[model samples]
Target: KEEERLRNVDVIRRNGRALGQIIDDILDLSKVEAGKISIEHIDFDLSELLGDIFLLFSRKAQEKGIQFSIESTTSVPSRLVSDPTRIRQILINMVSNALKFTHEGSLRVIFHWKYETTDQFPRSGLLTFQIIDTGVGINDVHQERLFQPFTQAEDSIARQFGGTGLGLVLSRQLAKLLGGNVDLEWSEPGKGSCFRVTIEAVDSAESSQSVPHFLLSETKSASSEDEIVMTLDGIRILLAEDAPDNQLLITHILESSGAEVEVVGNGRDAVDHALAGRYHLVLMDVQMPILSGHEASQELRSRGYCGPIVALTAHAMVEERQRSHDLGYDDYLTKPIDSLKLIQTIRLHAKDQDDVKRENFVATKFSSIDSLS
Candidate 1:
């Protein structure tokens, strides 16, 4: 009975995650259509990004008894200035589709780049990715409508595969937004398909070296499970949330990471508790009774409460984030919170006093040595 209960819980969690993804996809599509989507160009490690994708799909491929690999066919920069989030999203959608249709054989991702001199960006280039999969390939009739919203290859594929059929639509739109495009290079029914995604990227000033071939099979020994573990042991947090479900959810997430969480339903109580007690961090929900989160945060800041106060809201717009920052919030997080990100945010703001003291001591000793030298 215990084992059965655990399995049921796992199923529920999986379904919840799937539902969340669907909602996020819908919101993203709406933003794209409304011209509200924004693209950011920042220098990020290309190798790290590809490694994350490899780690994500390699295990699934292993489970399905299919080979998976990612290789840089040509000289690829180690870093690039592009929107990593959108890039990952587009690649994930394509790879997910490939995996969904492919029941047997192998899946491979090949990426490379060609430098081009442009007026706006001196070190710009077209970075292309090709996801090749041996799957139940699409025919001509179905291929034509593949990029349409809510339209899959066929009705039977929709029934059997269970998807919203928005992946391709979103992928193409996002790629275009990044000054690139997504295309089906080739497909043969009952054979395989190759998806090509090309996007403009500015080579980072520091990335002069090219990345070497990276193979999934070679990285099998390096456990993807060896991820950085985040903990908030012995930290105190004040949570200001009106919704009972959100309060419960947030509390559970924090307590599981060894944090001491005190929940208050109103902003007034939050202010009172935070002022009276010493808390490492405060999670203030934007909407509440008695006083709004913004009002309470402003009040706290006025009263010289120096601890970090993070805003929580359902709004994921850039204006909303800017408003939170302008209102003196240390950070902003959207609803249906990602647990890992939440933990990371808290850890970043709530520093351990012992660690701080140790760091200070080390710095002092180093300074003394420098003086002697």
Candidate 2:
């Protein structure tokens, strides 16, 4: 009976996570459709990113008794400036789709790059990723509808695979946002498929040099079984959330990291409590009763509160993130919050006693110098 109960609980947890992912994908699709999605260009090590992907999918391939490998050419620059997040998303989608369809044979990810000298960028190139999978290939008729929203090649695929069919649509949209596109190079029924994703990337100034090990410290492989252990000792967090479930969830996650969390039901109470108490950081839910998170943050700033205020919202739109910054939020986080991200945000923004004393000392020293001058 206990084992059965545990199994049921596991099923519930898995289903909840699936539902959460579906909701997040739908939000992303809506943002893309509304022309609100934005791309970010930042220097990233291509090798490190591909290594992380290999770590993520290799285990799954092993579990299924299938071979998985990633190969990159020497000409492909190690460092490139592009939207790493979107690129990772697209590649993950492609690889995941490939793995799902593939039961037996091997899967490979080939990275190829072609450099071009342009007036704007001396070192620019097209980075292409080919996800080749030996899977149950799609027919021509099914391939036509692959990019359609909420669609699959065949209805039976959904029944067997259990997917909402938003991955391909989002992948293509995101690739286009990054100045690229995803295409099916070739596929034969009962044989295999190859998906090619091409994006524009400029070689960073430091592309020739290797990325420091310390710089990749945070780039760890994703593991569901391991619990994140981090100490946020002597940190105090103000959590402004109207939802009881969110309040509990955030409080538990923060508490587990050894941080003190005080929950407020509304923005009004949040402002009052925040003013009355000393907090290292504030996690403000964007939409709250009486006063919204934005209004509350503005009020706090107006009242001369200098602590970091991070906006927490369900809105994943780029404009919503920009508005949070415009409204005095130190940072923005979209919900349902990943515990690791929440803890990392707190650790990044929370100021301990030593930090406070140092800042105060610096201010005093600067003010004394100014007075003397």
Candidate 3:
């Protein structure tokens, strides 16, 4: 019975995550259509980004009996200048489409770039991403309107395979916004499809050239001055959740990241705990007995509890988010919760905002915190 209960909880969490992703995707596509999407050019690890993409789609493809792999023609630089979010968005869309159509065989992503070497940094180069999949390819006659906002290849296809159908359109708009372009390189009915994107990239040396600061544990001395901040390990966390399943899932997730968590059933307990305890973070669910998360947060702030407080809610309404923000919540996250984003948000908002900007801080400082927990 215990095992079955845990399995049911996992199923609920997964379905919540899927629904959350669909909502997020719709909002992103709408932003694209309204020409309000922002493209940020920031320095990020190229290898790390691609590796994450590979890991994400690899699991999905595996679940559907499709082989997935990433290949590179040349040595991709470790650090590159580009908008990781948009690049990731494009890759994610292509991979989702590939997985949706492909039943068997393999899905492969190839990275090829042409660069010019300079004395200091690698000059801007054309980076080509080719996604090849052995799937039910679209016919030429229907391919003309493939990138339109509200249309798919056929009505029957949309019924058989469910989607918002704005994925390809949003991908094109995002690629162009990033000074790149997306094209259906080649496709033949019953064979497969090849989608390609070309973008410009320059090498970034900030990571290679900086001395970084890192989170430090309360006990251990730092090896270098950089790793001397507060670590996540041993930090007390108060989780205000009414649902037993969510409490279990969230506790497991936070504990996995080395945080010591305490659970409370109502907003009243949450406020009482926050006032008496020295928690480093709080995961507050919005709807609770006695008082809502908003009320609890307002009370906490009123009592000068300045720690990072994040809201877990299913509502995506603008007024709901603004109300939470106005009520002194530090950050808001929609449910079912995304474990990775949850960790990142905690780590990000736990420390001072300026502290997170140091490009060289490694995550190992926090990993050791797990041992303490």
Give lDDT per model, in order. 0.79, 0.76, 0.72
Better of 1 and 2 by TM-score: 1
Q: Tens digit of lDDT per residue, candidate 2, span 192-239?
A: 999999999898987486433222112123353442244676677789
Model 1 steric clash total? 0
Candidate 1 local lDDT, 1-373, one digit each (tens)? 9999999999888777767767777888998999877677877678866766675677677666667888988999988988876898898889988988898888999998999869988999999999999999999989998899988889999888778889889999999988999999999999999999999999999868777866444223224554324567777788999999998899999999888889999989999998888677789999999999999988987987766788888897756766776676877778888775588666645542334212121111101100000
Candidate 3 residue runs with Cα over 4 Å from true position? 1-20, 116-122, 207-245, 252-261, 264-332, 336-373
Between candidates 1 and 2, the lDDT winner? 1
Clashing pairs in 3: 216-229
Using lDDT as the yardstick, the better of models 1 and 3 is 1
Q: Give the winner by TM-score: 1 or 3.
A: 1
- Ordering by TM-score: 1, 2, 3
Provide TM-scores for the models.
0.73, 0.69, 0.65
The full ranking of all candidates by lDDT, starting with the best, is 1, 2, 3
- Index of the highest-TM-score prediction: 1
* Model 2 segments more than 4 A misplaced: 51-59, 210-244, 251-284, 287-310, 328-331, 338-373
